[model samples]
Target chain A: MPYFAQLYNFACWLIGDRVAAEDLVQETMLKALRGFSSYQQGTNFRAWIYRILRNTFLTSQTGLKATASLDSEDDALPEPATLETPESILLVRHEQSAIRSALESLPIDFREVILLSDVEEMSYQEISQALGVPMGTVMSRLSRARKAMRGLLTAASEGVKR
Target chain B: MTCDTWRERLDAYIDDSFPPEELNQLEEHLRVCPSCAAEALHRLKLKHATKAAAAARFAPSSEFRSRIAQGMPSRRKRLFGDLWIPGLAVAAAILIALAGSSVWEWHAQRQQALAELVDLHVTTLASVNPVDVISTDRHTVKPWFQGKLPFSFNLPELENSPFRLLGGKLVYFNHAPGAQLLCASGKHQISVFILQGDWKFALSGTFPASAREKGFNIESTRSADLRILLVSDANPGDIHELAELLKAAQQP
Candidate 1:
């Protein structure tokens, strides 16, 4: 159940639509079950499952439009205030929302690398295997993705100052 | 190293991809360069922020789960039904046409041949005897293929390449007798089946293009009238390589 929730969350982040993400995750789970006989146990099940989720999201016809809309809407949103006072819970929520919005604005490949590397804390080798790329490609993508994400956050922070 | 060099190395340093000496130099450069230090700090902070944002997880509604689960099997069954029903019907009609003459006996023989092909496929899969040679070595496997079939079937050395030979088994496909070679690259498995004879069968509008099937990726190509079907879980690019290798192996 915990695994499902984690996968569901990652799916939601990837697709940016809760309903569709859930459907993708469930489909991934079903695939994993059917192909379980072929699965090599004691390996990284999480990466295996995440790879399925990513593929499912990529192939979904409805996903393209939903992700586009989400990306646009996220870009239009304002950054959240970073005030740390206990009474400023709403401000924190706003900030978190803004951060999520910024994340959603990144390109799908960049966003995926960032999510897998930073968010999921997967190693470059694992990320490469899951994404079916070489280790060098994984490292380069992660570097580029982090640079892009940092630029976005910095811009958001600068926007608040302005 | 300059700050620019250190900046580029920063991510690798964090990933620990750098050697110990290079990493030490990177750390030393970061300590001395304020701009690089600030960049590293910003990167670290962003990493944490992104991690926190992703940790804000959400679950899919129960209704959505039920809907997807219900949809997949029906889709698969429908595909299988569409392919096999017409196939069975066509076989039945061919039998009816041949029932009255000596040609009917020939037709019966053809029908029997087709049935035997399907039976061969089922038996190979069912008995776990999918491969005659069970080594990853191309030399060993290729020799096992020698003197086994009438024509020379060249087995490429794919174990050194991306496609590691899993094993080879004799199976029937398209109502023709053939050899099925199973190979894997990483976690993806590819089943390459080579059959005898010169029949060119188009699978269009029959098996959903093999691309639509969720877990399996398949590609079929022919050489010297020998049909090869390569199916795998790898992406199309990698699978196509297998096809090209098979085609190359067939050459002088």
Candidate 2:
């Protein structure tokens, strides 16, 4: 049951729609069951399940939307904010909703890295395998993803201050 | 580490990906470099806030949990799951084991038989005496086997076909005397081995049983009183075509 909830939460974040997330999680469960024999024991079970779910999403209609949106790589690595630290802003006071909206507005790729790194706390190795990318790609993507996320959150907070 | 390098690695540092020695170096840099220190602090705050917000936002609803529970598959159905017949399960188990071994043995024998037939094909191609009657004429090849075998078989006319009649030989399969007609398609040689028997019992097949082993395509069929097996390394499609031709021309 805990496993299902975790998967559901991840799925909900990935697709950003409740009904679609439920259906995606259910399909992931079905595929995991059917191909369970191929899954070797004494391995990262969580990573294995996440990899399956990730693959299912990639090939799905929603995943296609995510892939299509990834084509606009112009803003993939936004410039880092170099202004003096806004210490007077007390960012954490307004961070909860600002950060959530920031994550919600970000592209699927950036959101994926943040969710894996910050939310799930998956290791770099596990993230590489789960996302089916090279280790170096995971590092660079995660770096860019975090930078992009901060940009979003900063922008949201600035807009709210106005 | 320089500020630029530390900037590139700030996320990894916070994610604790750096080795302890490198981490110590970065922390030493952070102590002196207030800019790098401030950047790390902001990154840490951002990571913390995002984790908390994502956790609070994406919790699966109770209804979703119930849906998943309902979708969970039950244990796979077993043959003896419900019914408990007196001594039935034991008898079934014994019968299954015997049947399994026999089926495996039968499959092994069939594979061995195909291998032997393939060997015969290779050896015949190399042998000096490939056929008892070496003739391309169907009329001559068809009659040369009379009185030598218990049954007669039809030979397809290959006058204009890609397959040319090379010759025919007398062969044995399972101690049963049969006719082996050797034919050719371009560079490939084809051997058709025919055994005489009650067609239905000998074949137990209405259609040709085809297999490929040891680089040879083999097709077996029953036509009239002959159990015909064709072996070749030629194209599989061509083998089936020749098999169909032989099946069509056999005397009813």
Candidate 3:
């Protein structure tokens, strides 16, 4: 019950539908409840459920497409601009709705990392558990996601010139 | 540490994931290096903005909460339960494990404050009579809290906007009495809470920082000695617009 809301929100963001997210969360909870014995004592409960939720999504209709795109151009990504520049300083406006579009436009892998790291404030280790990947992968994905986001937001703000 | 090395550790430093030994070393380095400090500030702002951008996330309705809650077994360990019949309690347990076992102390405290605020919002929603004072007029709503709270606040004129003032009630946040005004845009209800600014340090950094509690979007900012929070499942822009109005109302 404590983190029920966070799970539902994460599900909604991933599934992009309130109704589907609700079903997915129920299914995740039910699956966990049934698989309780399988849950190792030391495994993070939060990350374990998040992994189950993602696995559930992958098997579901909408998240199936996410798996296909998972291997999309990790190395082909453009090098991101650093925060050291004066021009980049002005691009960091929190109120820019363009940021939402920029975030939405990112690849699913990048978007998920951004959501887990930034929005949900999960640590690298926790995100690794949620993603079932090494900690290094989490770091790289987060780095690339921010870089990609910076690229998109910079372009967006320039277009609007606000 | 070299700036390049510091730059690599910047995200970890900003995220507060690096070890305490490295944390102090990094802070010492930042103290002498203006360039690194500016870069750190810039990186922190981007992180803030990215998090702020995600304020548009969907909030689950109370019905969903109830449905899931009721679906789970009330008191069973469910350790050996059949996999086909699942329950909601297990999921809740996992999500609550979100509390990083080793995270900084302040992070837990801030999360607690955000959780409390969310709980207060949820409690209000479930109540039969949500508001103590019932009136849409800003003039009436503003006066209702006159000595009930330690401080006073202004309510925006929602004259031609899509928003309508529903009413307000007195709330106790962190054991401090305050005012919570209910408003609506379209079908979503928004709770605008004005509380004594005792925990200002919890929400450090910029005035208007955003946080998530459950699935709700919360935009909180400080005005004078009062802290204003707007919570709703409404879109981020709508919540922000209402937040701006509240801030403007406080201004001359």
Model 3 alpha-carbon miss at residue B7, Å: 1.6
Clash pairs (backbone) in predicted model 3: A30-B86
- Stretches of candidate 2 above 4 Å error? A72-78, A83-90, B72-252
CAPRI quality band, candidate 2: incorrect
Q: What would the per-residue lDDT of candidate 2 be over residues A12-82, giving only the tens digit for each residue?
A: 88888877776677666654543343345776677767876776676555675676656343464444467
Please give the distance, in angstroms, between residue A41's alpha carbon in candidate 2 and its true position after superposition.
1.0
Write down the TM-score of every candidate: 0.54, 0.55, 0.52
Predicted candidate 1 versus true structure: per-residue lDDT over B132-241, tens digit per residue: 67988777776776765656688776755877887875443432346777788678767777876464233221222234233456676777756666666578888888
Off by over 4 Å in 3: A70-96, B72-252
Write the residue-wise lDDT of candidate 2 on B1-252 in tens digits: 479998899888888887777887899999999989988888887777677778746666777676556554223332222212223333443355456655433443464456446645654564444676899999999899899788788888888788999998776444346788899998998998878754322454432388886567898876776677889989888887888888888966
User: Once model 2 is optimally superposed onto the true structure by TM-score, how far is the C-alpha of residue B234 displaced, in angstroms?
Assistant: 28
Q: Write the per-residue lDDT of candidate 3 for residues B144-235, one digit (tens) a residue.
A: 88987778888889988889998998765544578888898999998999987766443454333787655788998877777888888898
Candidates in order: C-alpha RMSD to true structure: 15.5, 21.1, 23.5
What fraction of the reference interface contacts is present in each model, in order? 0.29, 0.33, 0.34
The candidates' interface RMSDs, in order, read 14.7, 18.8, 15.8
Q: Please report how far candidate 3 places residue B205 from its true position, in Å.
A: 57
Instruction: Sort all candidates by TM-score, best to worst.
Output: 2, 1, 3
